[model samples]
Target: MPVIKDTFGYLQDDRRVDRITLSHPRSGFSVEILEYGARIRAINFPHARRGPVNTVLSYASLREYELDTAALGAIIGRCANRTVARAHPEFQLSCNDGPNHLHGGLIGFGRSLWRAVACVDGGSPGVLLELQSPDGDEGYRGNVSVQMEVRLDSPLSFRTVVTATTDRATPLNLTLHPYFNLTGDPDVSIDDHELRLAAATYLPVSQDQIPTGEIRAVDGTPLDFRQRTPIGARIHETDGGYDHYCPLLPGSAVAAELSSRRSGIRLSVSTNQRGIQFYSGNSLAGATPRMFRARVGLCLEPHGFPNALNEPTFPSIMVQPGETYRHDTRYLFAMTQD
Candidate 1:
């Protein structure tokens, strides 16, 4: 574990964007992290290829558009998924009463500056970033403290552990927003990739992309991913293409698998959350290539139910003062031939 500054002068916003590099001698793997949003900038696996790199889309070079605001590879928290306004049916609190509160009312953890805490001991092979948000910072209750730890187990795997504590009782849901390009080709769409999710049903959304408080079966719908299927196969039938929440089976383990046939790269996602939101990156619009399209990339966000606070039937998102909120999600990368 080494804490180094930007040697090539590539880092902008020096005060907020400190870099943390982790290397495993035996595994031959290296990972680079930025403290701005506690974002994972790069992951290099030597066994897969000499310079094979996995990144959450490069927002670093986009001057007109701020990288932090995009929530590229940041720790999203306080509340991870959507909330139907700020009104909690049980709690009787209407915070942002209109339609829904998506990702902590817009300017969530992605936009805030996190405090970097580094540990270089050989025993602790990773760095932890922490942030504290006062009550009502984003129009929500409870003063919350968030900690995100990035650890490199080997060249092929990186684990992110996010834990939080709140002084006041409030709904808490957290997840990582990482844009992955297994092929490393920005122009390439994830349509050809094969995906399989262990979900029986998914929450349907309305025109505004808000959950309708119904858990519909995915057996005959476009949301089905029980078996391997090409991502683009049924995307055109969907409004903006798959942006629904898939309910995970009870317990903690690997929930889904995404594989790119062309590159023989496989990504396995494991988490403790009860649901996973599969977003196909339908909102991405690139100005450079002059190619405006949907489903450019895919996101498998493991989290609690969307709008759980307002939906009485959904799982509980409330975190009491003394209870510590702990959740873990891991992305394991491997090379295979199909």
Candidate 2:
């Protein structure tokens, strides 16, 4: 396993972006990342029979969306979810209340430039992208340091590990936002895809799309995806389509699984987070007409409770001084003929 670095591309605004490539020869898998927030740019999985490699997502096209700072396939953090407008004594964070603080304030880890530190662990290849933010960078107190590791274990698995430390007490929630397309067809809608989430209840949101702090049962609701079902089956029944956080049932370790019946592609998501956000990409305003429609691509964001800062009863997002914040999420890919 070897870690290699190279210059990727610079935004028109004159920000430098670097690329890291990690390869696992045994598994015939490789991954590339852009140094901007250490975002995952592309993953290549060799066919089972040693055929041409199949790309999971459009890595190059992602740059186009970078114009708006979409943070595509980047590690988001400081606070992964929304925070209400107010101050919490324990966490020492102030919420604007105007809208929930999303993805670590507006300029989250995704938008920040990270220092690339290339390293290999034993025989495993990976790179650690580090960023240190001064206190109040995003209206949060305390200086925060974040390290994001992108590892290529096999062609089938890409692991993301995020760890952070703060000098003063603050709120911390972090997660990766990867836009996946198993079929490699960006224009194809995932409506026909089947998904199963290991959850019984979900947090409902208000008209403004902020969590109402109420945990509602998923049974008999469009939010239910406990069993395998087509993504588009109940999408229209909901507001613009699913965007709420699904709370996993007790003892459920496997957060969710998605499969493309046509491509025989399967992705199993494992996480320690308390909630999983099933975003149906309802807000995808693509530039081209051939781009997939809303609800075409789905996001299974493993994270802490959404709007946690506003709801006192929810899991605490506090990160105190001298304490380290850590979260691990894995997306394992496999192929089946079913």
Candidate 3:
């Protein structure tokens, strides 16, 4: 059985909201999620050296999360990343991200409250977070039902499965937004983290930070993560520490791996999504009173490419009626040898 606990009390628009935490005792892994935004409040892992510590950046109060410009530990939905804009009024979306519709516009899933419940799937214990988006909500046409299941599967592994069904065809790309730091210390940066990716091709973004409809080879660019390398080795070369999508190569296999020598913790990421957005958290920190600073944590969001609604050559992100949209991501944690 999963150990469930009531966390902080959040006051949003006079509604008293509460955060819930589900933990696996044997693995020493815990995930805290909030009703507001169905967002992850914190992900606590057993540090090989530092005892139990939260690996993801987060805020202590709901007020800080209310002002969170960065997605933080949230379930980004309606669409995970940025959406395109057309000159025609009929095709225009909310301009929240400086002319783009980011994370489902101004009041996206990250800022909205969700219906949450505790559930046990099979023999594994988890939490089911649900949300119903009305037709035309966030400029999308459809009454969409989104469900996210966060499961703690015993020692050193957790799973996130996001599914949605809509009455109308619409762009539906859902993904996780967790700025992770394997190191238990919040003061230290993730520049020294060792990362390796199985992906070989990546989507190049324009100056506007939107994918340029180009799927380029990673062999010669700084986007290459085929071999294990220090994250900061070429981060300075990117516009602001990698924020582009790396489409997973053919076959069913592990997508990426991240390890930290400081804490002896290793995180292996596996996903079924076509694209993974690697962000170095360049624009993080300073947004909240929390310990959020640039370069401190990194996010690996696996899903469809950003602006896919407008890009034809990119992977299809349309969720039509009678069809189910599903994406699954897993994080396997292990302790490195001393």
Candidate 4:
């Protein structure tokens, strides 16, 4: 295993951006990351039928990635999801999504540059990226330093660990946003992918797509994926496509499982977070011709609940001085016969 580093592109300010690749020759598993947003450029894995296929949605050039609004394969931070307007009287943030804040405001971590370096973790090739957010960034109260390590844990598995520390109390939730197309083809939608999640309850949303602070059982609703089911099975039943949060059930180390029959590729998701956000890529609009349609990919985000700052009943996303916040998530891939 060797780590390769190259110049991706230059910013408008002429700052050099780098691209790092970690590859396992034997298993033919590779991951490409960019320093611009600490984003994942691509995840290439061996397919049963195809020689090697990229499992995540990616743009053609750095400019396309810079203009990406869907986040694509980037790291979202400061606050991963929406934080409703007026959520807190003391904390006022810039509203990017309608009247509420989405994915840490307009110039959030996902849109910022990070310093990255190649590293070795447990004899595995990895990249360590760090970003420093100044005080009053996006109207937050603290100067925060965050470190994210993307490691190739095994031939077919990759893991991410994010740790942060703030000088003042701040609402912090970071997660990697990667649109997965298990079929490895942008023309093929994820509608046929079979998915099962370890969730018994899900948070209901309001007309604005913000959580209503009510937790409902998924037993009879279309949100229920306790059993393996096709993504398109009950997608039409939702307002748009699935863009809800499911609280992970306890006692299980695994959070979700997704498989594509066309490529015979399966993905297992595991995380230490309390819940997972399942997005069906309903709003995706890619510059590529084959990726112009929605539902071409989907996202599984592991982090704290959305609008948790306003919901007292929900888990806290607050990080105080001297306290370190850490989140670990892993993605494992395999080839399945059926």
TM-score of each: 0.88, 0.89, 0.94, 0.96
Clashing pairs in 2: 29-155, 83-101, 85-95, 85-97
Residue-level lDDT of model 3, residues 152-218, one tens digit each, is 8766678988899999888888888888998866678999998888889988877778888888999
lDDT of 2 at 51: 51
Worst 10 residues of 1 by lDDT: 60-69
Give the least accurate 10-residue stretch of model 4, judged by summed lDDT: 284-293
Candidate 1, residues 148-251: lDDT per residue as tens digits? 88876655676888889988988888887776767766678889988989898999887777788899999888788888888888888888678889998666
- lDDT of model 4 at residue 48? 50
> All candidates' lDDT scores?
0.72, 0.73, 0.81, 0.88
Determine which window of 10 residues in candidate 3 has minimal summed lDDT.
Answer: 84-93
Q: Which has the better TM-score: candidate 3, or candidate 4?
A: 4
How would the candidate models be sorted by TM-score, starting from the highest? 4, 3, 2, 1
* Candidate 3 lDDT (Cα, 0 to 1): 0.81
Candidate number with greatest TM-score: 4
